[model samples]
Structures are given as structure tokens and as C-alpha cells.
Target: MASCKQVESMIQAWIDGELGDSERVILDQHFQECPLCTITLRKQQRCAALLFEGFADHRLRHSIRQRVMENLPEMEPLRVDLEGVNWRGHDTKPKRAWLGPLMRMAAVFILICLASLLYSAWPKGEKNFDGAVGMITQTEGAAFRETGHGLFCRSVALKDFVKFGAFYKTGPNSHLMVSLRGPTQLRIDENTRFQICDDRKIRVETGRVALDVSRDERKFRVLTPSGTITVYGTVFEVSVDSVQTLVTLQSGALQVESAGAQGELKPGEQTCFTRGQNAITTRTVDTAQVLGWTKAIMPDSEAYDRFAREVQPLKIAELPGEQVFAVITTKNGKPRAVSSFCLAWNPATDGEERCGYDVHVYNEAMHELFSVHVDGSVFANPNRRSHEIDAPGAPIVNAGVLHVKIVPDNSAGKQTPLKVSAVGL
Candidate 1:
């Protein structure tokens, strides 16, 4: 004499296939004897079959089919009133209808989590080859020279003509960002060795160098056979020889920490470090003089004026204050002209001198025709005449100002002016 409530509970568990063999046998006996409960069970079974059939055929359009099926067994038939059934010896409330939505939400959350995990596990691309070797630009004969044992050398083919430094190691040049403030030239003497350690540390085994450091925080490391030099947004020079090392400060400030002792080098100051010694000797020198090795004539009012005076007889001294110089030549008795100027400067402040330059040109109206900021060419010799302004184009025309400034190996922040003028045929 199973109660109606007992039959209903069994019906739900049977539909879900959760009944064990003993419980299933008890429910089967009840269904055979109870005509009313039997009728209700048959109807619910038909509904269950229809639902599953649709799911198996892929005809159910809902995205939450699993969740809907989980709750199907709990649903009552149209003729039956679950409230009248005595559920068990004690009564318990039915499960909430929203359980289906909650289960579906949990499934969605799990899928999203799995997708994120896969994305995070994906492999990244390899690092750039040039970056790994600390080579920033491949200008002139500035190319990477491979050395044995995971090391590389940055060497320039045109030595006397192009005095530029190369990264000598397997890692990216830690000082590559120094170029942004302006071009920096590092001169690595023949048979000298340098190493780029990772992307931040540098080691110089044997060599002499002149560095024009830029005003960037990351551009702050210099190493020598004797010691290491660290800088923060400053211009300076460093050199290393067999017996001693030299460090000169051109502008800004630098702090040298080595051998358990620290020293500060200021503008116009130089420090000498002897091999196997922890002591550093400091002395004062003309900032400009110490940086002269890297200085070269740069395009400016003074250089321009010197060029004009040499090319033409125009007395620039008598020219109106507002008037500027322009280069002119006589072609078949007609005045034909190319208004331009060239100037050079030093790229290094150390013992090694490297030259860089700028070019400027103006029209007849005293308006700037063109201008260009250039460093030593990759194809030109360091000693041979180098032109910073390559064949004139749009950059010059848009410069707008008639006066141009130039600095030669100028770590001192002083710019030389060059004046230009047209020559009369």
C-alpha cells in the first residue's frame, strides 16, 4: 500500500535513472498494483521519451538542453496534483525552479575559464636576431661580426672614415636607446673586445671608447677592463687600456661605483682608475677640451659664414641684420644657385673621436630652402669628407627657419653658427 506521494518520488528518481536495483524493484511492484499511480507514471514516461527523442535528434533548439532535462523528472503531469501527495513520513519543499538557469550559468563560466587557460598557455614569438646581438642600426659597414662561444662583435669596415661603435656580445645592446637623444658614436679600436651582458649590463675586455650618451634613463651603463661606469641622463666619455681606465664627464652628472668605493664625476671633471687598485683619482679638465676627440665642424651660423666667405667675396659683415647667406653660381651669364651649407661635430667624448654633421640650404629671399640633420654616412670613410645632407628633398624645404645651428664634438651644449651667401658671377 505505497502512498501516492511515495509513488510520485519514485517516478521522478526512476525517470532520472537514479534508482538502485532494490528501490527499482519496490517501485515496480507498486506500479503493478496501483492503477491510478500506474496511469500517471505512463503519461510522465511518454513525456520523458518525447523530450529525450527531440534532444537525440538535435531538434531541441535551446542552448540549455542539459539543464532543462535535469528538471524534467520533477515536473508533474496535467491530471496529477503533487500538493495532495504525502511526499514521505515528513514533508519537504520542492526544489526551486531556477536551478536550471543556475546550472547553465555555471557551465558557461567553466567554458570561459577553460578558454582563458588555453590562450595563456600559447607560445610567444622568438626575439629579434639583431636585438639579441645588441645591434641597433646597420649603417655603413656597421654589421654584426660573429665570434665563437655565443658572442658577436659590432665592427665597422671603414675605420678611419666611419668611427662608430658596435655591440660585442650575444645579447641586445643595452645602450641602443642612447641614440634617441642624438646620435652617439662609439669608437672601438682594433683588437678591442666588448661584451653585452643580457640587455642591461656591459663589459669591455680591452679597448678605448668615446661615448656620447643620450639623456635617457635606460642609457646608463659603460664597462671597462678596470671598472664599470653608470650614468643617468648625462653626456660623458669612457676609455679602457691595459694598465688604467679614464672617465670624463662632458655635461650633466655621473656616479661611478666600483671596488667598494663610489665617486661622482661632474661637468669638467675626469677620473682615472688604475688596474688592481680600489682608489680613483679625480682631476679637473676643460670639458670642451676633453671632448675634442669627437668634435667635428657642424653646420651652424659660424660654419655657414666661414663657408660663404671662402666661396664668395660678399662682405658678410656689411649685410643687413635680417639678411642671411645663400650660395649662388653664374651659369652662362645667368645666376644659377644651390643655397646650402655643411658642418660637422664629434659623436664621442672619450679618447676615440667620431664625427657627425648637419646640412642647411636657403633660397634667394633669405628663406630656408632645405635643411637636414645627418651623422657620418655608412658608406663614407671616417676621415674622408662626409655629407650629412644627402641629396635635398622635402625635409629641407619644411625646416622654415633661415638660421641653422651646428655643434662639433660639442658635449658642452654650445652650437656654432654658419652663415651662407650667394657668389656673384
Candidate 2:
């Protein structure tokens, strides 16, 4: 016979016939001698029948629990007489009967949240991708209202919803945003399986997911097949597969725990571990490519196009902020070549050695690519008529780069912003 403590969790499974024969036999015998158990079972059956007869679903139960969890924390814990309530031959009547209206309000609230997500996800001339108040990142296709026992979709839903989110899977072409509470936002690549283990922990079983976790006192965790990342508010990524596990930290601080060993990760650091192995080695990473998916748009590759590769005069002045410099540069300047807006400008200092200037190149996303510091002493003529700086270590020249941020020689302490009008691609 099962004890009271043992039967608490099994009651629902037994009611749903999810228990095996041995388990059922044990529970049945115990209930015969236990009035509390028997009474509780009867009430459960009545509630289940009433619920099924009216408006009840697995999702609804989950929704209710989540709502309760979120709001329950704000409420004072209530004390009730458990033994008297479930005793035999007692009419279990509640003291207050305001439950009906509370249920109605909760249902209304759930509906409003669903409607909000639908409106936000549906394209309305422009994406309502505004400030992320909360997150519900999901995959491409969806079938609403589960018809059968299966729910086939992967999405970002129910952030800070007070309960664990079940395992979610994404199929091919499943590049979708990863929204979490922290009100953190991230995106997962395709063919990924992950689960929210708890309020403070998530596990990525396979494939890649990146998150920008908000800084907080709580210790959130991202677990992978290789190791676990204990975060203290950071942007990072984890990937899992048969052979290896990879973790990349973009910013913030985190600790990676591997096989019997752990190490803290610094920003721009990457670490990978082989399956069932302990060795951990870290290397520097170029996050512009690894974390590019998080960007508003892809990195600029137009600089390589034939026409875009040619060099011509940009002949412009000043800088364009916020606007896509790529679009503006393509329209006004020749591709693949970087030229000053004007033919030349004489410096206040009569051309010091090393030009005392070098230019830093960036893609449209403002990721610094390379810096070029020219020795003004290179040109014999003393005056720089057409200041066409060649891209050091890069064959592309300045054709289709986003823009120049800074060009400083060894004297970065006295560095000034590059005054190039436009860089053509």
C-alpha cells in the first residue's frame, strides 16, 4: 500500500490511466483504508469531470499553473486545515465562492496575451519588433489548437511564466529569435532541441542558441552536452552535437564547468570540448560573424561585386549616422575604392612621418575590420592630392566597406575620427 506522501504526485497520473497495473493496485488498496485519500480522489474526479465537460485542456492547466506561479509569489501564503477539508463524510464547501469570476478574468487575460502575440508576429506593413518587453521566440510554421496528442512547434513563449517550459525543437530553416525573461533576447539556429529546465536554468541538447542575458543577482545557467555556463549577465552562445560542445562569450562574465574542471570566460573568448572529454582550450573569436545573426541585417558582402570593386571618387563630406551607409555609399560613390570627399586637405602640421594617421575599416554593422596608418612620408610629393588609402592585408581596398571609424597612427591616445566622406563598395 502506498503512503500519503507517495500518492500525492501519482494521483493525477492514476486518474489519467498513465499508471501501470502494479501502481494502480497499490494505490487502490491504500485508498480503501485511507479516508483522506479516498475523499481527495473523489473530489479530483469530480473536478476533472466538470473541467472536461466545460473548458479544460492540458495547455489550460499549464497556463493556470503558470499564472498562479507568477502571481502567487506576490501573495501571502495562505494557511488551511488540510485534514478537516479532506476528511470523510464532510461536505467540502468553500468559505468564499468568488472563484467563478476569478476564473473568468484569468481566461480573459490569457486570451489577450495570445491576441497580442498574434498581432505582433503577423506582418503589419512593418514588423512590430519594438523594444522587447517580453519574449516568445518561435519557429516558422504552427498549427493552433492541438488536434491530437502531439504539439509540433518550437517557439519562444511564456517568459518568466513561473513554471518550466518543456523541450522545444526546431526543424530545418528554423532561424528564429530567442526571447527569454531578463527580458533577454536571442535567436537559435535550425534543428535545435532545448528545454527550460527551471526558472534559472536552460539546457541546449543539440544545435546552437545565443542569449543576451540581463544582469541580475540570480545565477542563471546554460547547459550543453559539453559543459555548463554559469552566467552573471552576459551575451554568449552554446552549441551541442555528437562530437563536441562549444561555448562563446561575447560580453559579460560567465564560468564554464566541464568534466571535473571549470574556468571563467572573458568576453571575446571561445572554448570547446570533445564529448566525454575533459580538456578545455580557449581561443579568441570574431563575434561579428559568429554572432551576426543577432544583428539587424547580415554583414556587408557587396564590396566584392565586380562593379562595386572598382575605385572612384567619393567626393563627399561629413558622416551619415543611423542610416545604412552601404545604401548611401553605393548610390553616390564608386565601388571597391575609398576616396576622400575632396581631392585633398593640407594638414595644420606639414605632414609628419607616419602620416600620424591610420584609418580603421568597418562593415555596415560597425564591426572594425582593419586599421591603416599611412606614413605621410611615403609619398614624395609632400601633398596628398587624392588621399586613396589602400587596405592593408586586404585586397578589397575600400570598395564596399561600410565606413571608416578611425584612422590613427601609433598615437591612438591622440586619435581622431577618420574624415573620409564615403567608402564605395
Q: Best candidate, lDDT-wise?
A: 2
All candidates: TM-score: 0.32, 0.36
Clashes, model 2: 20
Task: List per-prediction Cα lDDT, in the order shown.
Answer: 0.48, 0.55
lDDT of 1: 0.48
- Considering summed lDDT, which 10 consecutive residues are worst modelled in model 2? 306-315
Error of 1 at 19 (Å): 99
User: Could you report the Cα RMSD, in angstroms, for every candidate shown?
Assistant: 24.4, 27.0
Give the per-residue lDDT digits (tens) of candidate 2, residues 360-403.
55654457666655554433244443466555553444334344
Question: Candidate 2: RMSD over Cα atoms?
Answer: 27.0
* lDDT for each residue of candidate 1 in 1-425, tens digit (9 for 90 to 100): 45867778679777787766656666788789888988989899999988888789676466887888888777653443333432343344345567878999999999999997665444222232222222232222223333335352333221111112334421222121111112233434334456545333456766544565433223356777667687534667676778777888888666664564456676889998864555556899887876674444122344234323332232122211111221223333234432344443233233233333344444423454554654433213335432334435423332222333232332222232333333221
List clash counts for every candidate, in order: 34, 20
